[model samples]
Target: MSTNTLAPVLTPERLATAYSYSSYRQLIDELQAQGKTTGLQQSAALTHYTHLNVQRMQRLDKTTQVVPELREAVQNLQQSYMWLVLTEGWCGDAAQIVPVLEAIAQASNGRFTTRYFLRDENLDLMDRYLTNGSRSIPKLVVLRVDTLQEVAQWGPRPAEAQALFLSLKSSGATHEEYAEKVHAWYARNKTQATQQELLTLVRDLA
Candidate 1:
């Protein structure tokens, strides 16, 4: 099994004490208002931001960022699946992916909701959902809200993101070059331009 080597102390006590449910809701609302059916590129940026929220990271720097494509997809979205985002501060998988998913959810209205599962604190939830008998972090499980159907899952990967790394290996690339390729691939793959596309994709899976 892979492991996290960052070893940055999470200051769990501080994090737990400072947790604010209302603040999280407000952030979602804020992002939603800013995101409407604009274009795929903008949708991509917003989705990236949403994934960051789930990872509990600070927002990206705007000067280096592109304008997000917002669409009015939220109004017509139908909730089909409930998503469980299991994460930790030091886990790279959570860092890169979860926030984008959260952004997509906000764009889709309330079609999606996420609960943060801090593995250090929520071991029971981790055991029920993730834990393949080890103590790693960052597991995302998809469940259909109405029928409780499990849709898909992926995670506990490292900064190099194994799946992404492999996908970038077809050419003679340096490590830095590979990293750029992986980031570009991930960014493009996550964004959904229209409500119809989002609905069709999620519906196919659910």
Candidate 2:
């Protein structure tokens, strides 16, 4: 059977239940206190990642400077869009990207708004936008708010980060080694790649 057939249809009703960026962060903070992680799987490693993710998010939330080009592109948008993102607190990629997304949306005035969905809770939606058949978090689905139809999508990681991840995985690097390198790349790039890519996406919509 085709993989597409396995995914659930995304309805507006379903989308409405997703969390706001603020609420999603709050959920993570709340979960952290309980020593829990999102999704069905629970482990010390995952929980540790979740805690690290929160710190990453907090740092990014404080420091992510939205490029003027992206802000202008979003502000010029004639149509409003729903920036639906699939993610998890333990996802390092999501940790680095989602806050930048939120900052962009905030700069949009009201034309771009972000909604956060936990990947484990929204597997059906995540199935629709897999990367190499892997259910990668931080998948963005840009939807026209008026019609609720998808216009563009992006995710999992920026191109450079994806490349680094692939190289590490193929080279038999330990998971810790792989994660460290990828995150260090993010630290150096400092959201520039992500913002530039999203700027292109936003411009096309205008």
lDDT of each: 0.47, 0.87
* Every model's TM-score: 0.45, 0.94
Q: How well does model 2 score by local distance difference test?
A: 0.87
Residues 102-190 of candidate 2 have per-residue lDDT tens digits of 99999999998888888888787789889999998799988767666777888888999999999999999998999999999999999
- lDDT string, candidate 1, 38-64, tens digits: 112346544555444443334321111
Which pairs, if any, clash in model 2? Answer: none
After superposing all C-alphas onto the true structure, candidate 2 shows an RMSD in angstroms of 3.4
lDDT of 1 at 127: 73
Reference-based TM-score, model 2:
0.94
